[model samples]
Target: MGTGPAPGRERFLAGAAEVGLQVDVVARAAAGSLAEAASLLGISPADIVKSLVVKHKDGTFLFALIPGDRQISWPKLRALVGVNKLSLPPADVALDATGYERGTITPLGSTHPWPVYADAAITGKRISMGAGAHGYSAFVDADALTAALRAVVADISDPN
Candidate 1:
């Protein structure tokens, strides 16, 4: 890592703090899969969450929190959002929307406070997710995180 301040990390930390959410950020080596990342972190894959940026049909976005062990259930999400269409925006659009690259995107410090949809599987567990920057993961109580962000909790995912 470079010997310098990481603005992405700073923004994420600040955002979490602003919402009174306590987060512990740890450096991580690049991993090819959720299982690999979980192994490296010594945690269950279910304890690792992926922060996915989902685009609404109306040129807006929402954050979808899916467990590493599962994938987004599009039909369920669409139903929950009361929409017929949703998509994973292109990387550039996602970066523009969240001020963080795809792999590091998290709602904690997004450029805009887009709505959040969290999978019910992660509720009440301690989970790890993107730290607003590459090579890092942030750990926090899932319940606290959702509460802090006022996320919509539902069964929005299926096994990967």
Candidate 2:
């Protein structure tokens, strides 16, 4: 599930439309931190989300959508995933798995539709996250995103 060519803009947009998920794609520059990025984007830190790819020992993977203001609570996520061990795969491994670089990984255009887990705190907000490419972000309603991906909504993160 972690080996394949990266998908491009075509697939990214296509996947979103296929799932009936409305997204607003915007260009962005590198920032020192999430807060700075949000500030530059004229949004709150909570609006900036991170898509974390968790690798299981069995080689399967899952997507953890965490708000910038919070972090993945390993114990909570572990329990939800019912796994004893999970890790952030190396950059190369992650790229191979989802066809997107670490900074631009998104399930919207991932090579495989790995299970997605979204933190409940973000459910009713509009959030921005990786858009399958560097220098870009995808803004979407969390509810729509969760529904589109059929994500498991839970308390998988802790305030940062």
Candidate 3:
């Protein structure tokens, strides 16, 4: 760990710790995308879990964790969640709900406690994700991450 938490990494680490999940926070100069982040961290993109914020037609927000190499299947997600429609919330709404910017948002410590859905592929080992801020990341066991977030594991990712 550095002298201080980098950007939003601290929040996720704290949240993980509270739930008994061990986390290793890493800081980088500029990793704007999963590919870049992976390169800088010396890991594969598939090992990077991306946190996405989506809104239901009823205006409720939820979080989804997908592999960096994949994309969310909106249709499957809606059906799995039993929602009529789902789409990314507006930037302002996402920020308001998650208390972090789009790229840095994590399921941990959101302004509102929202349900979390994680891709089934994210299992069996350790994974990395944004720590509520950009240019920073945290590593935790995949199962532990899901457990900490109380996430529903599902095959909601598309092979994109």
Which candidate number has the best TM-score?
1
Q: List the residue pairs that clash in candidate 2.
A: 2-96, 2-97, 6-99
Residue 159 lDDT, candidate 1, scale 0-100: 92
What's the distance in Å from true for residue 160, model 2?
1.5
Q: In candidate 1, what are the lDDT values of residues 1-160, reduced to their tens digit?
A: 4543388899999999999999999998999888999999999999999999999999999999999999999999999999999999999999999999977899998899999999999998999999998889999999999999999999999998
Estimate the TM-score of every prediction.
0.96, 0.92, 0.91
Q: How high a TM-score does candidate 1 get? A: 0.96
- Whichever of 1 and 3 has more TM-score, that candidate is 1
lDDT of 1: 0.94
Q: For residues 18-113, what per-residue lDDT tens digits would candidate 2 score against the true structure?
A: 899999988788777779889888999988889999998899999999999999999999999898899999999888888888877888978999
Candidate 3 at residue 85, lDDT? Answer: 82
Which ranges in model 2 have alpha carbons more than 4 Å from their true place? 1-7
**Candidate with the greatest lDDT versus the true structure:** 1
